[model samples]
Target: MKKPLDSEVFSSMLDASISYWRQQGKKGVWIKLPLELSNLVEAATKAGFRYHHAEPDYLMLVRWIPNNTPDVLPANASHRVSIGAFVMNSKREVLVVQEKYGRFSGIGLWKLPTGAVDEGEDICTAATREVKEETGIDTDFVEVLAFRQGHKSFFQKSDLFFICMLQPRSFDIQKQASEIEAAQWMPIDEYAAQPLVGGNELVNLITKVCLARFGGTYNGFSPQLTTSASGKQTFLYFNGHFP
Candidate 1:
């Protein structure tokens, strides 16, 4: 609100707006309430608004104006996307790091350079960027080898973690000081011998897949740049090598 009005005036204005929207045949109405204007929530609810979603700075409320039609407003994002770079060099060594934080911290588990995908970032770009950021190793995005989906993770939201195969361009390691405790190019065989890898079923499967990819016996989803009907540029990932 530009100026904080008393609940009486705010309710009056809300009623007028709703009437105007109904007259215009609007199907959905959304209102964003700033944190400072929380006192107006009661007025909004009395006018037939319900909670939609919320963020750190604001609360979003919505109302379906057309009673005859179903509410078709899309839901907020329900999944977080992350990536793990399976970067291999010509020396048969995979880039790995010991994070200074998270579950792997202080456990001596050497894992791939991994990070969450930033807003508006593509999966392939996220993999390469994560590798460069954590290990200072430049890499070329190859393909998305595999992905896992898990529910009830990270604030009760589902998560998609993609395993990306990347070919290293520059092998020099300059570990991120704040997040990575140590980083190195470890022999793939030796890296797979770690207790964490040998013990976990999922990790073992991933290791085998990486070996298969290295041996040219496996293929993953490759990104093809394409434009939608709306003329927006985007990547369509699929098995491009298929006949």
Candidate 2:
């Protein structure tokens, strides 16, 4: 009789085989190895599979499981009043506001004209109100594109992002003394080059989302984590950190 393969060796071989098969676009390959393959069994378990015993070898079985459906946002959700906006102009430049107060101060970075969604107001209504209050621009039609939440943060609040198309209106850009320092419309390239208050990961996610909508590029959104100087870690898009 042949000696059984070592568990460690079996695991390594299994991993390598899986990688090769994945690269080749092959699906659902199983391995029958020895019962002494403890490491292989553990790895298969971690990969959402179960192991069974066969006559001379252990049977490694894999099953495809669909991801659980995400929970639906409450119709009357009153978590927090955070908001983000995507304001585009006739010149193809997007309007991003600099946060004057809070943790993102003096960053010279760009962000959507957003603020808290007031109590007793719908997200769309709150978005319109925030834009008007922040940038002095009144937007009539508000459309929500995506919703985001952070894992954890300093502020301990949820951020709601809306993709809104503005109506034809004329107004002067003014900064609210209490909240914003400066406001401007910058081209996509210029905005992309500027540093982001939320960090590089956030900027990348926002860029991908915007490009997919307006620039015909469709890379999906990637979440980010930002750790502040004060040792407070906040999940970007899920919450805001205020200094």
lDDT of every predicted structure (CA atoms) = 0.92, 0.59
Alpha-carbon TM-score of each model against the true structure: 0.89, 0.51
1-243 in candidate 2: lDDT tens per residue? 135666566567666766776677655544554556444666666655554334455554553333354423222222464667776766777777888888677866677787766666555566667777778876664244455665334244344454443442545677677898888777877787766633488656766676566654432232245687889764333212247
The alpha-carbon lDDT assigned to residue 146 of candidate 1 equals 92
- Runs in model 1 lying further than 4 Å from the true structure: 1-4, 19-27, 34-39, 65-72
Cα lDDT over the full model 1:
0.92
Range of the 10 consecutive residues with the lowest summed lDDT in candidate 1: 1-10
Looking at model 2, how many pairs of residues clash? Answer: 5
lDDT (Cα, tens digit) per residue for candidate 1, span 71-101? 9988878999999899888889999999998
Top candidate when judged by lDDT against the true structure:
1
